[model samples]
Target: MTHSSDLLPPPGDESAGALRVQNLDLNLLKTFNAVYAEKHVGRAALRLGITQPSVSHALGRLRLLFHDALFVRTGGGVEPTPRAQRLAASIDRSLAILQAVLDEGAQFSPATSRRTFRLYMSDFAESAFLPTLLRELDGRAPGVVIETLHIEENQFNVAIESGRIDFAMGNFPHAFSHFHHCELLQERYVLMMPRRVAERYALDDHFVLDSTVPPALQFIAVSSHPQSTALLEQHGLASRVRVAVPNFMVVPAILYRCDYALILPRTVARAFAPLGEMAAFEIANASTWPVNAYWHRRFDADPGHRWLRALLIELFRIGTREPHESWLAIPPNLRPSALNP
Candidate 1:
């Protein structure tokens, strides 16, 4: 009887020119990655620019090469076998390396590259980064499209591991060992309220915390992560939650409709201050949120990935410097106001 390892080729096993010399085809590995990503052979076929029959043939080869069903059909969809699940991460990394090599000489001119970047970010990050990033992309990569997936902090690792998201940028205190990280920006918390409230109470005046208080401030809590929720508790303000929400994009619109105070990053509050409907004041707490760019280690060396990340870093750098309202726990006369404000 032959052992399983005997039938399998070792890592990086390949002949110079013959596909038959090795039982596995590198092209089939690409097909496998697509099918695993889509979970449907038809969609995988379209992604690989091949016919459905060809995809099926590739899947058949993959199954025989590994001597496992690889994908088992159930409930009108297919699920990866245990072996296939184990092979997934390495296969994705390998394919990326292979593709990078095949196109090593190509230029990564963002202006001409029509690619869609799927980014995972919390609504808070989106509110802070989107406006400036969009403007820059319009002038740089006009045809590059962006799609965002709202990520709860805990779901970040799984999202990046599955190759479903290219990057996750958010304010979370996470140390992901499997991916690369860069600090895009750091912001302190601010208390934003309507103009009337700012006038009624001084920044130093201590306010009582209560659940029954009328909705004096529209507190926009980002519902996706415990970290955002934890900020208030860590600062002894958990009982002050009057409004619970999930997206920062909707905060401005909601604040425009009512008088509400929310705890947000100074940068974020500043970005929305120009809307002409609200004001922002700095909270005394020294808590900070760090915006990070996270990508899988597999793509760390890929030229295209590097180019896109560099552009994003530049965009974030320029956007965070915009002048706006300053919320500080001090008298207005002592604060340095924005030059334009």
Candidate 2:
């Protein structure tokens, strides 16, 4: 990587003043950051809401200012030069700081703000959370937009760090470190099955591979969360799984069609319960986990982010704390006023 000192222009040279960053336009830096992230001018332009020619023009100006090619054309897309790699981190951080400073001087009113926040969620969480969230937003922050994205678990850190997503909300079984999160609610898995299938099992006993369960109890495993599917394999019932789905959207249809039970969150099962075609039974002593809303520490003070978070807490976190659940223990130093006040 090119060292930072290598970027310095010759001292006392009259022509070298233009190379200084303070003289650089913020738009050039924004374009550079977007290009560095996307590695393609077309994609960078799309991300920045500008035309491809405009992005190229900004890159040309940035190259003259930095005196480095910064990005080299490749067969697929451009790859950052060593100089660009060294500068990218600092530039991104500087941009974030400037944005925060501007936000501090500005106020965000939910009733009027038109900010679009990207939230990460699975189809399961979306089905359970989005309707209620959108309903509340219609009454409170009608102009604020919520765009939900399906991001893999491994990409959560990168998504939040790059400002691609505003929040990660779900039933996360483990904590993702170096972030702040508050428990939205506690959820346990339940056996959601055809009413006839549910009638075959006894709800009072713990869920076992072989109880007084039906002789034809086939399983419809939802593959979105491993724990739900893993519970079946752990009990040596993998061979009994008749089919697998990627999400909960089709579970209700499958339950009505066959003598199958799906292991899914109680919150989702609760929604299906009112449908009357199926029955949801709690698995006694089954694994339980907390649903949480996570955000980066860097965005802890932004007004719109805070307002949306406050609204989420109001909607999901009801009643007293459950005893001895470590994941429910939100950090004491978080923005308490937005959450509790």
Candidate 3:
């Protein structure tokens, strides 16, 4: 089989003449960087808000330009070839320098820039912040588009480190250290049930006891968290999950007309409360989860990235305090600070 190096056009070949003689399309470098950063064409496409086919097309062009496969699929998604790996450091440096030059020129304006900013978030984030954020962006930054991307915890750090993503906000696991993080806020987990159901039965058994509270009352769960199960067992309630939904949105959507109770974060509950008439109660055994914003150091000095980060911080501020500080202020219903505070 012919390897990538063998595919390089000859020094004087007509195909190589144009790229050598004239202006090279620097956009190709962005494509190359994305591929290198994500190590997967599919993910790079999502990051760039393009199609997998487009990423593949870009890779084909990059392969011809560099005469290297650049990346080859492996047991762990796609891995860069030796030539591509060797080019990474230099390519990153070049990209950073280019971004620096662009930043120096007053070309990017968040208010007028028609750029799409991509974010990685959890389902809870999607439910809590995305709608308001989109409306705000539309009314203010008419040209901006917000793209929410899905993240896999196992591969997330590598993707973040490579500059495949501009920023990500969520309850990221603690082991990821390759990127810089800003504490966005902390939110408490709560119990959600239709107000009617909550009124009919007092929460006397503790948050966890509802599991075996008779199958007459069902339980809806955010399937990913281990705490959901533990919370049930803690109250000596055998939580027999009648329905397990993957996202917070789905939990409330399903519970609206039914008697099922859900365990979720308060931020999520408030967002969906009006739609479902769902009421939230502090989960006695639940602890708050920290939410953070993260970015690769590569974009730390880029003006556009700086602007975007600042905008997010501004919007999340509450009560004249930053989101991080305001998390301590309990909502009116749960105003008494906990001993944990």
Candidate 4:
């Protein structure tokens, strides 16, 4: 005979549902998530870095608010009720989003950070820079992770704009106003060939093209950069090019096995020269280019991006002791003119 509305709690009553929501503490929800994961009050307290009594007190308040026993004791541990399980699913997602929001503004600490940086690089850049960079990282930021993707010149801008690539390392001629860039080094081209090829033809470090070597020398062209091949064609060396490979890393092994010669950046060439099976020589009329690190302007003020940029600049900047020391020992004639006084 009574109306259903009369069964609801009276307005402004302390026990009303609105009062419960208004008095709800976010900290209690955090405790709930911990207990939900651990399934034991004592272990949940340990996970939350709080006392066991504190977890039990919060659970009591949660039970009073929900009007149900959210967890029940079992021989193994505590088990969640049907209502508790449903609450846990929503609570977990909400906490994850909240944590992400907090992290977006947090200060970056490379020494303790487990952050993974995504990079876009050419095989040439990877071969030249990764060895020393990895060693430096091991000594400085042991927890940081670096993942590299092949640089696709055609899709480079799109990737950067969409935030798919955190940084791009290579020589990109065109600069975008919407992006930021810092020149790491000036690089020039060099021709690399096997030690046996130089010994077999009695070729000097300064190779001279002649009727005997020009026709017989097999040129190994990398397909990533068209400019390198164009430079060879410009100098009338393209006709002898018989093999075209996609990666610069493979050029060294191929040169070691055959009489193939590769035109590569000086830094990349020097990195492979230490293998004891190949040699590097300055190529005549080779083009010089600036290697740079590119990032979108949206990350200009991001502390993490700034840290990464500064790290790269410190390691490879022009005139820096680390990179200069390695290439300075090369004869002045063999060094790039851009690097020369």
lDDT of 4 by residue, 180-237 (tens): 8888887877767876776777776666333235456779888886777876787778
lDDT of 1 at 205: 27
Most TM-score-accurate candidate: 4
Query: Cα miss at 255, model 4 (Å)?
Result: 1.5
Error of 4 at 203 (Å): 2.8
TM-score-based ranking: 4, 3, 2, 1
lDDT of 2 by residue, 1-341 (tens): 65423454465656555466568899999999999999999999999999999998888777768777898889999999899999999999999999988876566888977889999976666766777788778989899899988777787778878889898887554445888888877767766676566556644323343344565678888877788877777655678899988878877777767778777776676555443455655554577777788888899878788888898887777523532211222233321221121
Please identify model 3 stretches exceeding 4 Å from their true place: 1-107, 202-216, 317-341
C-alpha RMSD values across all candidates: 17.7, 18.2, 18.9, 10.1
- Estimate the TM-score of every prediction: 0.56, 0.59, 0.60, 0.63
Instruction: Order the candidates by lDDT, highest first.
Output: 4, 2, 3, 1
User: Judged by lDDT against the true structure, how good is candidate 4?
Assistant: 0.75
Q: How well does candidate 2 match the true structure in TM-score terms?
A: 0.59
The 10-residue segment of model 3 with minimum total lDDT is 320-329
- Give the Å error, residue 337, model 2: 37
Worst-scoring 10-residue span by lDDT in model 2: 332-341
How many times do residue backbones clash in model 3? Answer: 1
